[model samples]
Target: MSKVTLAIGGMSCASCALSIEAEVKKIDGVLESSVNYATETAYFEISDDKLLDVIKSKVQSLGFSTSDELHTPTEKTSGENYLVKFYISIALSLLLFSLAMWPLMGWPNREVNWFIQLVLCLPIWAWIGLKFQKSLVRFFLTGKSNMNTLIGLGTTAAFVYSAIITVFNDASVSFGLTQKVYFEAVGFIISFVYLGNYFEERAKRKTKEALNSLFKLSSKKALVEIDSKFVEVDIDEVQKGSVLRVKPGEKFPVDGKILRGSSLIDESMITGEPVPLLKSSDDLVYSGTINGDSVIEYIATKVGKDTFLSQIIAFVEQAQGSRPKIQQFADRISSIFTPVVIAISVLTFICWFFLGPEPFWGNAISNMIAVLVIACPCALGLATPTAVVVATGRASLKGILIGGGEIIERSEKIDTIIFDKTGTITEGRPSVVEALFNNDEETTLMDIASIEQFSEHPLSNAIVKYSQDRKIPLSEPDSFEIVKGKGIIASIDEREYVIGNKLLLEESSIEFQQNLTPNEIGSYVFVACNGVHCATLVVGDKIKSTSKSVIDELKFLGIETWMITGDNEIVAEYVAKELGIEHFVANALPLEKSSYVESLQAKGKNVAMIGDGVNDAPALAKANVSMAMGTGADVAMNASDVTLVKGDLSKAIDFLKLSHGTMKIIKQNLFLSMVYNSLLIPIAAGVLVIFDGPMMPPVLASIAMGLSSISVVSNSLRIKTII
Candidate 1:
């Protein structure tokens, strides 16, 4: 399957987005499609790449436009600016309203006064009519309705009715009807709705601030070494394997490994950690990170869209466009909202015409226009997506890459969190703390290092580094084999060697005396050679300082914490105790770890797994929510729901806090929108008119409808401050 993102244009509300999505999904070879009204973008997966153009054409046929590029702040929209239109509409509407109120001020309201009001309302009505005409045209052509449909219907009805009253002033006496024209109502309705759209659009732009900041962090220029001399060039001109020079306090233009010089690099842009890290030869530096206090020459390994910063931006964009489960409810309601509201408006006009007081025609038309103007589908559509976009973007700024809105919803319900011991709770860097041998120490160490050099395990690397540090010469083993969850078996100089934990030694039938006791609490490896015990090596890794505090905070939040590791029971117990964790599993292989997570889920627990190694991938994918350390293996990160850059465990806490805050805001927005429509639609329909209660004027109804959408967007923006 192939995926494509298109910048959608001419989307006025959520219903327009639904129409585009429905039309695009009907195309052959289109697998799945989603359109985010708040972001004004559509994401799709298709069976064939050729269907992309077909999908775009389908969207355009629905009275909208599509661009191949993803939507950005600077991108031009096909629609007119509502803010500028609102300014013009309001200025004219105020004059029309004053003319209608001339009688209330004890002034003679002449026929020319009515003509003057009509002239003032003309420009305002024409501008907003053109703005909503596409929605009306789409409804006629495709049998779909949107928020703009209601606005267009209500405003046009008022304008037409008032135009007839203005032209025939004496006919009202014979028909026993009120002679008041609603030119002012038409102008106010269009003006207020435009003002509401202006505020909503402005708030939506603020939600993307975090993503825009990331885009701005990328360096535009690079100094490359050509002919052994440096020449500044555009960042795009530099290719992979090109050597580049970065001066003090300049941002690195690409992801590369340092070949010469050293410096303290400030990587806070990617890692969200303020402390600059000391980087030397062979250390990898990423794009968008600032160089600190020294000159460094590095060979670019990854450039352009392949850079780390670009990938993060892409992830953020995809996540912000995703629809969460909570949004599905709102989407369903919005799909039929316009049609249902129009039916109610028609019903309102019939009831008020027959049952209302004197001036029945006037009351019926005014109430029907109010009903159509006040029912807002925009608020319902903006509720969840606006919150999701803001929260996901804010989370990315803190180096927490949430997979999508689904992850955020799941994160809020996590009751049990499982952490991998290595590189998660503790620092993954292991060192040889102590070593003892029964036979020749040098020869035994040489034999162990020779076999371990071929292994990619952290323990193996530590042992190899220890031997090299001690100046012990090594030889390649004749044969080598790795025992899963155990150690290694190798042959050197016609003698077989067994090197692993105690389980591997006993399984190999190697006799070894248990005479050594280490003062340090660390992982132990027992080695035997030719059926004789040779050496006992101890590898120690320190616990991270934040692990204990993070665990304590989780406990305070009424969450259970569990530790799982592949190390021996002794090492696991020590690390668990240090972190104040009571539940733990030791000597667990990759499959065993996954099984433990499944068991927790089977017991009705919402478990979140955090890990940072290849061995943790299975368990990470099995948990309710999986978080991967940024410094860990690629496989583990890919399988995870959230990536904590710089491998900071504290970011897991940040993710939970952000999820809770975002979900809360979404619920608030939904409740406010539902309640606004529920309470006001009846008032607009003349529910209280029989009891002699005041009727909702079309002007007031338009204001209420506009404010409903603006309030929801404004409420969604509050998540940034709370999180």
Candidate 2:
């Protein structure tokens, strides 16, 4: 199946995303679909690409706009303009509120002020309140209710009731209405709701800014050599095999190999390292990295979406669109919240009308309007997603690439962390340390290096470099064959030789008079000729400086740390002791490492596996949360959920801390919303009126509702401050 990402518009809340997702799934041949309100994008998978147009039409039918165009369009100006409208509405609201309160304050001329308040509220509702009206009408047509439906119904009820009192003064007075007016409440409700949206839009924009920062690092234009002459062209015009000439201090425009010259390139954007790397002939340079002091010419290998920079951008975009498990729960609650609130408002109206004291009509209408105004579900809808967006963006800035919301949840719960030895705890660069031979060490080394020269394994390269540095003459091998994870077999000097691990030798039924093993803390590779042991060589790798500190930090947090390695028991124990790790599994195969992780999880531990080699991919996929070193193999990175761009083990602590902090903020937001609704709903329903308590005014209800949403957003933004 093929997929497409469309830029969606007109999404106001999480419920809006749900509405779009529900419609998109109905299209024939659509395998799956996800709509994210935070990013305002819709991703779809289709079995047949021919039905794309029909799917787009289905999305638009739900009253949302979409574009398949390249390069994201700039945001609309509605947020800024809405703020201006709110200020004007608020000014008029304050004036109308003061005039309507004149009678309660024992001031004169309050009896004739209803007409003036009504006239002032007209502009507020007709102009600033039109959005709520339009949303309410759309919902009425589709039988769907949202926050807008509640606000529109509450404010419109107040304005219409107040207008009736103003027009039929004599009849209202006869019915003991006393010309009571709530025009001021109508003005305040609309103003506060709009103000809430304006603030929300501002916070959402801050999250978008974090994502856009990545796109800004790329250069738009490039200078290339055409027929030995330099020419400037757009980055898109430079194709594969094109020779691109980059000057000092300019960014590389495409992934390429150096053809001439050398320079120190800054790869901080891509690798999260501020240090400059030296580049020369045959070295690779990626797009968006800055060339530091010398001009260089390179031939482009990958262009457009195939470049490394584009992949990072695409990765971040896809991650931003994913919903965490907590966010899914929030969406489900919001889907049911609006309708339940509408039902409560109706019940509140019935209860107040039958039980209210003098001026029953005015009290019943006011209290019922208060109930509707106070119960907006916007805060509930925004609780999880806003926190996820801010937390993910903050993590990106710190060089931790989290794949989705579920990673945040999973990372927080990790109680045990398992680390692979090679390329993880150790530097993964092994060098021959000692050579033990029964007859001649030189003959064995030269013969083994010759056959291993054709292999790209790490140990193979180390053997070849060791032989070359010793000035040992090598002979060609015939009929070379490699057994993965074991050894290589070839014919050297009319004799069959095997070079590999002890397991490979045992499988070959090799026998030697004395099997000498190295006592040092390093790996051993045995060489055999004609099914007999010839020599044994030892290789050692340096441990990373941060491994011990990382282990200490994890232990300090009450988490257990374990080391799993394919190395011998002695080497594994030596490294584990140095890092202060208490648990380890030595001489483990790739499948055995994954089984160990599963066994820990079966014992109720939340396990996280960190590795940077192809052998670690299965274990990485088996853990609750997996991290891949930025400098590691591509297969390992693809199998992991989190990528440490600098390969710094210290970032593992940051990942856990970030998850804890983000989950804390989400819980706080959800609590604030739930508490606000719980306390205000009863008062708005007039339950307090029994004890002679003040009934909740529609104006105060609107203020409380808006503040609840603003507070949730403000709390989410606090995640950016986490270190």
- TM-score per prediction, in order, is 0.55, 0.57
- The window of 10 residues in a row where model 1 has the poorest summed lDDT is 71-80
> Per-residue error at 354 for model 1, in Å?
11
All predictions: root-mean-square deviation over Cα? 12.8, 12.5
Report the lDDT tens digits of candidate 2 across residue range 326-369: 44445456436657776787787677678768677766655666
Model 1, 1-723: lDDT tens digits are 988888787777667777788888888888898998767788899999888878877887787888976435443232247767877888888787688767667665567888898888877767655656566666767888755665566666667667767777677555444444667766766765675565456444433443555566679899999998999999989999999999998999999999998777876444322235668899999997889767999999999999876766565555446553343445456447767877898898899788777677767766776666556444654666667778878888888877655567778889999998878887777778889888788888998998999986667888999999999998999999987557898899998988888889888787768675456777688888888887788888767888989999999999999998887688788778878896998878665777898899899999999988656766776677889999976656755778898888998999999999988888898899888988898998889866788777545654565578689878988888855
Candidate 1 ranges with C-alpha deviation above 4 Å: 46-53, 69-81, 91-95, 170-180, 227-233, 324-334, 344-723
Worst 10 residues of 2 by lDDT: 267-276
Candidate closest to the true structure, highest TM-score? 2
* Total colliding residue pairs, candidate 1: 0
